[model samples]
Target: MDAAVAAIEESGPSGWSLRELARRAGVSHAAPAHHFGDKTGLLTALAAEGFGLLADALTAAGDGLLDLGVAYVRFAVRHRAYFEVMFRPELYRPDDPELTAARTRADELLGDAVRPLSPEPEAALAAWSIAHGFAGLWLSGALPPEVGTDPEAAARPVLGTLFPYDEDGRPAAEPPRER
Candidate 1:
């Protein structure tokens, strides 16, 4: 798994093979195939692992929506290899039971956090999109230098714009918008 993560980081999800992963892991060329069955199987496992890790991170962040958003970005940047493969459903089996359960867990965490903010279903989607979009921008180097190298710090204000909170984790009043 470590070798596979390294390969995904250095190349990309589709750029490496099971043979390459075996070679990097110092195992026989057929070892990865024997264990994971094929590249899709390996990626399915990776996607499941990524979602589980994400759920853990979000849970650690507590129930604060702002904190959850920051945690999402932090997980993506820290686990770039897993994050890359987890989102691209075309690369793996999205319907795999393990992957589905893991993904659903992460989604539920996010939805639970957003529920108090608005009763509307779109609120959860909007919150997820904001965090996911910001993470994608940070990973792609699309964010300006002024955003700084600290992902959590950078993410806080951006997420705050959508779901403002005070030091005590209570929702804060939105700032007045300019004409």
Candidate 2:
């Protein structure tokens, strides 16, 4: 899996092939195909792994939805290949069970993160849409170039708009304050 991720990172998703993944893994050329069935299968598994990581990160951030947003953006920037594969259904088989499960889990995690606000689905969607849009924009360089220079600093204001915050810079309406 690490080999697959490294290959995708080094050469983009288009360059990732089962043979190349097997070669990187020091396995037979057919090894990846045997295990994954094909490139799409491998990508589905990869997306699942990425979403699992995302779910964990979101859970860890607890009521700090702003931090969760930051973590998400950071994850995307750091795992460009996996993030793209996870979100861009056209690039892979969306019907794959692994991909479907991953997507569901990811959404559940996001829902949990936004639940504290008692937001209606529309509000939750809006908050998620903004965060997702910002992350996508940051990854695509659609945001100011300087934003990348210090992503956390640049994103704080935008996150503040999307995240409920008290006057003291802490997440509002959360107690025990830890999720």
> Which candidate tops lDDT?
1
lDDT of each: 0.91, 0.74
Q: How would you encode candidate 1's per-residue C-alpha lDDT over 20-110 as one tens digit per residue?
A: 8898999999999999899999999999999999999999999888889999999999999999999999999999999999999999999
Deviation of model 1 at 177, angstroms: 13
The CA lDDT at 173 in model 2 is 75
lDDT (10s digit) by residue, model 2, range 1-179: 88888987788776767887888899999988888888877877888888877777677765566777777777777777788777766667778777678778878777766777755676568667877788788877888766657666677678778666876545677532223
Indicate the worst ten consecutive residues by lDDT in candidate 1: 170-179
TM-score of each: 0.94, 0.83
Give every collision pair in model 2.
none
Counting clashing residue pairs in each candidate, in order, gives 0, 0
Error of 2 at 32 (Å): 0.5
Q: Which stretches of candidate 2 lie over 4 Å from their true place?
A: 167-179
